[model samples]
Target chain A: MKIEDKKRVLREMVLHRRFEERCYQAYIERKIGGFLHLYPGQEACCNGVMEAARPGHDYVITGYRDHVHAIKCGADPKEVMAELYGKETGSSKGRGGSMHIFDVAHRFMGGYALVGGPFPLAAGMAKAIQLKGGDEIAICFLGDAANNQGTFHETMNMAALWKLPVLFVCENNLYGIGTAIDRSTAVVHQHKRVAAYNIPADECDGQDIEVVYEHARKAVDHVRSGKGPYFLELLTYRYRGHSMSDSRGYRSREEEEMWKQRDPIFILRDRLIAAGEMTMADYEALEKETDAYIENEVIRFAEESPEPRVEDLEKYVLAERETQLPWLTGKAA
Target chain B: MAQIMYWEAIQRAHDEEMARDPLVICMGEDIGVAGGTYKATKGLYEKYGPLRVMDTPISENGFTGLAVGASFLGVRPIVEIMSVNFAWLAMDQMFNSAAKVRYMSGGQLAAPCVFRSAGGAAHQLGAQHSARMEKVFMGIAGLRVVTPSNPKQAYGLLKSAVRCDDPVFINEHELMYNMKGEVPDGEYFHPLEGSEIARSGTDVTLFGYNISVHWCLKAAEILDKQYGISAEVVDLYSLSPLDRDGIRKSVSKTHRAVIAEEDEAPVGVGSEVIAIINEECFFELDAAPVRVHSALVPQPYNHTLEKAAIPDHEDVVKAVLKMFGKA
Candidate 1:
């Protein structure tokens, strides 16, 4: 990657981290309700793949920890925050909270709440691409624990069978809620499990953007070139508990500190500074700018946005429900 | 008008729609090369080839969810589950993903997919195979559920379902594949949320759908000839919306009602029909609405036991006669 783009990525990683911290604060303040899964420690996983793939062109889907993926795929952070706040102007029009940040126009298909839900859907998008003869590929971002789902195997076999262009990026964050990967998963290495389905697979350090970028580019190339589905596992950790209510009693603070020592943003920033491409002052300025933007623009936009109208509660139940059932909308048949 | 079998009508709909737009694709086990278990998708594989008429493995949940996902990208996929009994495996994809995605995503995406499956009792296929699962699909808020009684409906409803920009689950009966009827020559799109009056009458209204509509029609004939009762048969093709207006209209005119269903009574189609009648047309009824349904037990394997377990035209006739105090 170019130094400018690398510098930009460093800034984005910083922005994503600060943005999520504010979301954490907003959740504590009760501004954001329902389940909120923040993507703090795993920014490089999604950013790396999204950078390698076409952000706004390639179809993207992931599990609930999806704010960063949506943003990377061109979803406005303000609109996303507005959605988190359940505002009318939010990305999902406030109907879907944090778990379902959908920006279809930008090809960010959605952030599904159901674990392992995006597998077949991702392949299905690839099928659509194949049918349309489009150059686009479907990029599915999921957690390592989601690999245990039956859909993981089912979709792998089908995508490989049909030669669908799908890149399954598994961000192995060490735990699925309270359950540690060792306790739940039979085969801890997610990339190895895809061998049964004959999918080309590999794993790398999710904390390092450069490593993630290198592996992600290779995997994306393979899938996009019609070599069938490729599974890329990025071993990582989540600094925060799975949800707001979770207390980090499952793992030791020593382990958390050890993982934090290699924080993705810090690593990228240091690398850029070491290469003489960026300075400490530049990093500080970017951090201060992002904090101000999140507080003033994103949070404020969400806070001031209108609540969805009660009468329009049935807006998205079915796209054509009004025409299909005219009586419901008080239209004459 | 053209005369054709029920399955052929479905295949014709597939052919027409797939030809009309390349986006319309079909996926299911035994659907492509095998031409579908009931031959509903017969000749489609040869016509559309492998890409358009793709065959999937026994992974119902996976493929169904995949089709739902494909529908997200405007690729209209008609997923056949081969048998409705297996739909229980794919309900998460149907209920959680296909039905709720649009609503949960605030209309940013809609799964314009058609899930077709053959359901209901069929020649002692056992309890596992005899699902009568339309009730389950109907209860889901966003998913559209429809069942066609004949070839004409099989043709038009499938066409309309392919065009609908929402997830539609067409619960076809397993026993009705060979049933023949005349369908319109040109394109015909059936209404997805209304009941058709198969046999109009004044004395009583008999509510049924899909395979049961045939039973209801037979009971109607028996009532008119043997008992001098003019019985109306309401083909409830659309189950999700329940066609409350049609139920009210029929009950208001007939003043008496009998709901016939092949499924067990508890929370089945009969239960919903009775509930709708009570809510919409309680005052119009001459007597309490009665339901003639199969015995509340797992469908047995033995022919005699299976025959006794499932409700047929004879049971409907008995219910109508008993309701009129003439049995």
Candidate 2:
């Protein structure tokens, strides 16, 4: 990779870490409600893939731990925060909360909450793009637990059979809400499972941003060439509990510290410093910039955003003017 | 127009839609090579091929979810469950995924899918296969439920259900498969959520749907022949988004009403119809509304018990006569 590319990746990782830290604080302060899954230790998997795919051309969808993914995919920070706050200015207009964030303009399909639910949707979107004669590819992200869902197999089978343009990325964070991958799945290597569908599969070190980017770029290229769907499993970890209310009793504190030694953000920062690509002053200035940006977003979402009105709840339940039936008028006999 | 059975009408609708639109597809167990269990899709596989007419494994949830996903990608899929009793296996995908996707995606996605299956008891098919579960789906939002009483309505409504951009449930009665009725030919699409008044009269109104509509018509004939009373019969084709105006207009002219359904009495679609009429035209009614329905019990396997469980023409006649103080 070039020195400029390394610097950009480092800057993006720093922004993601700071943004996640702000989300954690906001969640604790009651500014953000509902389930908040933090992406503290898995920044490289999100940043690396986002760098490989074209933002407006390639579509992206993922599981609930998606604040960083949305940011890396170029969604406005103010709108994301407003969505977390359940405000009308949010991306989904307060209808989809922390778990579901969609920005159709940027080709970010959504951040689905159900396990493995987005796999088939991503495949469908890829099929649509293929039918429309567009070269756009769909990248779907899921956790280790989602691999056990039936939708995973159903979607993979169809994608491979039809040779759809879809890239499946499994962020194997070692644990699914305290249950280790070994305990949950029969095979520890998650990538090999997709072999039954005859799709190409690979494993990459998610902590190394360059390695992640290289593998993801290659897999994405294969799908865009219409070869078939490709599965890329990234070995990573999470630094926080499953949610804000988890007891964290399933894993020991020593296990947590052992994985913390290979934190993606810290490793990228050290690599940048060693290569003389970035100075200490430059790193500190980036942190300050990110902090100010997040602070402005918090203020904009809290003070300027308005709550969704009571009458607006019934809106968006159906497509506007899509049905010609008269029963929707809510009139009496 | 030639006379056709109810099942043949459903088969014709599927064939015509698949031939008309390339995006329309059908999937179900034993539907491809063996046709459907009831032979409703007999020659579809040979005509449309495997890609459009698929034969799926017995995994209801898996195939149902796949149909939902396909619908999201702009494919109009008509998914057939062998029987409505087996729909419980796919309830998660139907109610949670298919029905909520449009609303949960903030109206960005639409599920243009139809789940068609045979419902109601067929002689001694036992308890498992004897349920008239149309009421269960009618209670759900974002889903349209239609039960056609005759071949003509079946042909029109099935085509409309496939074309509509919503999740529609078409409940077909097993006993009505062999009964023949006149049907229109060529391209036709009936408007959904509307009621059809089968018989016109001025003394009493009979509101019913599906097979019960036939019984209500029979009882109306008996009232005119034996008691010199005229009775009007209304066929409620669509259950959800019901045609309230049709029922109100009929009751206003007749001044007496009787609602009949093929399911149990308490909290059935008949109850809902009666509630709507009472609220809308209470002052126009001369007598309290009566409902004719099956007793609340699991359908028995014995022929005599099964015959006694469901309401027939006699029950409707007795209910009408009692309402007119002639019992």
List per-candidate RMSD values in Å. 2.1, 3.6
The candidate that wins on TM-score is: 1
Model 1 C-alpha lDDT per residue in residues A18-56, reported as the tens digit of each score: 999999999999999999898889998988888899999
Q: Model 2, stretches more than 4 Å misplaced? A: A1-5, A126-134, A153-165, A186-188, A195-200, A298-302, A321-333, B285-287
Q: Write the per-residue lDDT of candidate 2 for residues A1-333, one digit (tens) a residue.
A: 677877887877887788778878888899888898888889999888777888766888888888777777878878888888888888777777777777767777678777887787677667666655678888899987899988788778877876878999999998888788889999889999999999999999998888998998998889888897999999999889887777789899998898889999778878888878777787899999989877876546654799989887877654554454432331212
Per-residue accuracy of model 1 over B94-165 as CA lDDT, tens digit each: 998999998878888889899999988888799899868887898997898989999998988888888778
DockQ score for model 2: 0.32
Once model 1 is optimally superposed onto the true structure by TM-score, how far is the C-alpha of residue B71 displaced, in angstroms?
1.2
Tell me the TM-score of model 1: 0.97
Query: What DockQ, between 0 and 1, does each candidate earn?
Result: 0.54, 0.32
The C-alpha TM-scores of every prediction are: 0.97, 0.89
